[model samples]
Target chain A: MSATVDVAVIGATGAVGEALVQVLEERDFPLKTLHLLGVDEAVGHSVTFRGKNLRVRAADEFDFANVQVAFFVDEADVTRECLEAVRRGGCAVIDLSAGLPAGQAPIVVADVNPQVMASLKAPYWVSSPAAVSVALSCVLAAIAGQVEVTRASVTACLAVSSRDRQGVTELARQTAELLNARAMEPRLFDRQIAFNLLAQVEEPDNSGHGALERRIGNELKTLLTRPQLKVAVTCIQAPVFFGDSLNVSLQTEAAVDIPAVCAALDASPAIEYVEPGDYPTAVGDAVGQDVIYVGRVRGGIEDEREVNLWITSDNVRKGTAVNAVQLAELLIKDHLSKILT
Target chain B: MSATVDVAVIGATGAVGEALVQVLEERDFPLKTLHLLGVDEAVGHSVTFRGKNLRVRAADEFDFANVQVAFFVDEADVTRECLEAVRRGGCAVIDLSAGLPAGQAPIVVADVNPQVMASLKAPYWVSSPAAVSVALSCVLAAIAGQVEVTRASVTACLAVSSRDRQGVTELARQTAELLNARAMEPRLFDRQIAFNLLAQVEEPDNSGHGALERRIGNELKTLLTRPQLKVAVTCIQAPVFFGDSLNVSLQTEAAVDIPAVCAALDASPAIEYVEPGDYPTAVGDAVGQDVIYVGRVRGGIEDEREVNLWITSDNVRKGTAVNAVQLAELLIKDHLSKILT
Candidate 1:
């Protein structure tokens, strides 16, 4: 690993991509040059990074020859395409997508499974979990530690931003129109997103895996190494623009004493436990941070042996970009590049 | 049972009280005369019932004499005081508060366990479940059918209105202010209630049972007739103003079939299934309905035998006043008044 490396961030105009640029700069990652890639529509746009205006280039036209490490922040298809190009160009590709088509050892949250990337072969990819689930999984992994997670259920109060830039804009437009006594129609969401909540996120497949669910399940499996864990999720869309809040219940293999759980959570670097009577974690509280905020820990009813938790995190940060950047930092620290490629 | 009965509704200014008045009129329950009682501030205030302006009388000044039934909708202390007075007046009291002092049966949803009330030999006391839990428990009980509820977990998305009238006003005012670019402060909830979700409702007791949990557990035990059944609950405040939504997971004592559970739910008269892919029930959809709206039924993970469901009901309607009124109607039809007073 060099003191400074050439890095490329794909899907530069998207929400997570924008956060990726900011996170790299905020974390002071040593970068020789930063390449921003997006669709043709965003080609002429420029985002200021480290006091320099970096013009976005179309992913189809971008050259990956000199890019030592590339962060694929686009959709799964685009990411798959870019991974091939970057790998062929002899560059390490960190994919923040569902998974690298089977043979690739895709790195998950470096904190949870940093050792998985030690032998990074070709197409070095790191798949991040869905914004809502990753935060909880990361926090839980940090505190719970190797415990059998039997039953897990999550009810997500998702932000419109989960859809895309258009979703966020639609929320603002609908809210403004509704408040002004104007007729508001649903666009990004199935129903009104102004001062309301909708329960379904992605259309459920017969296999019970929506896009978000698949991502959550796959990423958690990669991070926690438990592929058979039982996870029931109900993702809801709230009127908020950014942070995602999840009410999660976990039935563990062993009894979870609340005090012990609290102590473990308090000691974790990636999680902050808000006291029971303190201001409970909400969307507003998590809008701009990188840490997963966990509070409101309680015992399960039928299984008093299990523990339930309420977790919230900036979906764009800890869920996506910040986590990707954190993985890059771990790779650099572990000096794994000497063994790969 | 008598063909005619005199009834008084205490705490007439609140959400539940308002719904109670509407329920009385909607059912036209053999009322010879109706009296509305409230605190000192609400005295002389008028509430319209069946097109007649009924002036609210002070709880202390309201006459309980000759009243066949008194519905106590105030705080526990207030309900306790009213019950003592009503009992002295030889009138039966259906107390909505937890202050009934333990000996009497806290009649949850009368439809689910009307037998609990039937076994009570005493006059002057009946109780109801908490608004949120009763809605889900009623649905579960209808399906479980005397099967032991081994474990039940509820993640409640409670409306601001659940906090009381002032909470409702605060939510509306703060939301408007937020939309108008005006700064707002938290009042009804521990945090901002406009565009965010707060994960804790009431302060959690040292035992992890908040006010919401205690009420739900008490209600479920009485309704299921399983005094020892365990219930774990996490109640959160959402942006919704009136309806309470719960994502519940439960394991029953019987081998549960998803199709059979769905059939039982469909057959239950007081519940309406909000089908999957249909607009998931929100607070606005349940503001004035009498039936508990349930949807998104799915099988549990690992234990394909367990079930998970999403339930939403107008907390003020089916959860409180409507259910109470429905009980009164059943009592009239069953001639349960032969044992009263």
Candidate 2:
């Protein structure tokens, strides 16, 4: 196995795409050729990866046969046929779209179920859950081994970047305009999200749960493999530009020892547990961090059977791009390199 | 009984104080001489009431004997001895501080237990819970009658104005500076609250629960008079300037009907229910409103005995100032009128 791997990154000019390019450089991804594909409008726009200025080309011209690995990062109109073509060409594709087709691929979080994901034998495509779910799945997996989680409830505060670059730019403009005592109109969200809290991140359905709220629950169930875990999530669009913050509470099958729970969490590789006094916050602790920052472990006043945790993670850096890179690394080492000659 | 009632508003120079002046004007409270008393720094400052301007006098120098009703708006250095002086002068006082003397008077939320509060015969000083507590307490009280709440958990996303005037101004300055790539220091809170979320609104203790968190529980237990009804609160300082948004979860003794719960909420005057798809948000629905905005009602999938709701209210207007004014109205009509000369 001596040939270098060729890679193509679709939607390469977007937020996750930008992060993927940086991660590729930082990790020195083993590649013979790196192709940056974007929309027709971004044809001449260039991105620097490993000190190489590569002009973006339209994805319509991309040849999947040459793409040993492809990253789908933007919410561009990707079709089943396009994905099938990439799959038929033996490309290891990682999707980070709003959602993926049911039973399409082994949906995964790298830290949670890496071994199973690594041993894939066929030309495959996998999908990463939303940023919030990716961060939360790690913590739940870490704790599930030590404590039997009977039920779970999560209140996720998503940052502006969860919507992408335009969301961030709009928040920047609106924040400035509002601070200057000028009225600012909402473009991406239904409410003024610059200096306010939008209670529902997506439209509410008949069940009174927003689309984003339902997605978090669905993805958590899929990742944890506990279909009846009693998951309830409320996604709030906060004003912050980065880091997904969550207030998570879980009811275990039995009473919990506070110190033991903290010890188990500290032992988890993907979790960074801060001491009580220095509580983990979105900007102060979690924005640039790779692992989920967790603190403020609390037990009930009289009953120790329940616990509350505060957690945060960089939604784009770690949640989407870094996880995608890790998954690709696992794929190449286990299966893709075997085909190289 | 026919003469207008004289009232003194002590510490009338804070955020709640500003809202107090406006609510009194809005409600057209029966008044004779509306005395505005402040600390020495605000001595010559004048506040308007019904097109009449009154200069602020030092609260320490004001005669309590002339006070028919007094509302404490600021969290200044209040003392038990000073409070005793007002009680000895036969004045009725309403304190808006954190901890009022136990057994001093009944701690009250106006809409929740108005009849009992109004019927108190003793000349007294009563305390009102914070705005977030005020909003949640009303909803809990309304539902407590229909179903027995075994336990409850709340995640309160408090607005910047929850801190005070400096908080609002700091957010204004920080929002502008952060947009321009300039860092602004935290002046009122423990962290940068503009475009960010502070995990803990108060200092942590042995339990890792912040002071605000503990206060919410302690106050709820006392208000509901159900010391065993488990309560846990996580207070997050959000960037919004006015509304307090909270995610509430409850475990009732029996299964809950979603529509019936919505109907019960709508039947309560203090709660304003928002239908699904039109979920109530902080800036869009709750800010400046008098009622607690409730939306997103959902029952647990596996266990119908549990329920979740999203609520918001103007922490200053209805949370603090409006409740104080309403308490005064009850005091004057049911208790003070019997003692009037």
User: Tens digits of per-residue lDDT for model 1 on A1-341?
Assistant: 45577898888888888899999999899787999988758788998899889999888877787777788878778876766677677776677765467646464675567777665555455566567656866776876553557767777788888887988899888877876789777787777777677767777665333567656755565567777777777777887788888888787888777787888788888887777666445566778898888887767655656787788888888888988887777666555445332
Number of the top lDDT candidate:
2
Q: Looking at model 2, what is the TM-score of chain A?
A: 0.94
Q: Which stretch of 10 consecutive residues in model 1 chain B shows the poorest summed lDDT?
A: B332-341
lDDT tens per residue, model 2, B144-249: 7667888788899998888788888888877777777875777777777777888888778898887777777877877878888887788888988888999988
Error of 2 at A141 (Å): 2.2
How high a TM-score does candidate 1 get? 0.94
Residue pairs with backbone atoms closer than 3 Å in model 1 (clashes): A301-B232, A302-B151
Best by DockQ: 2
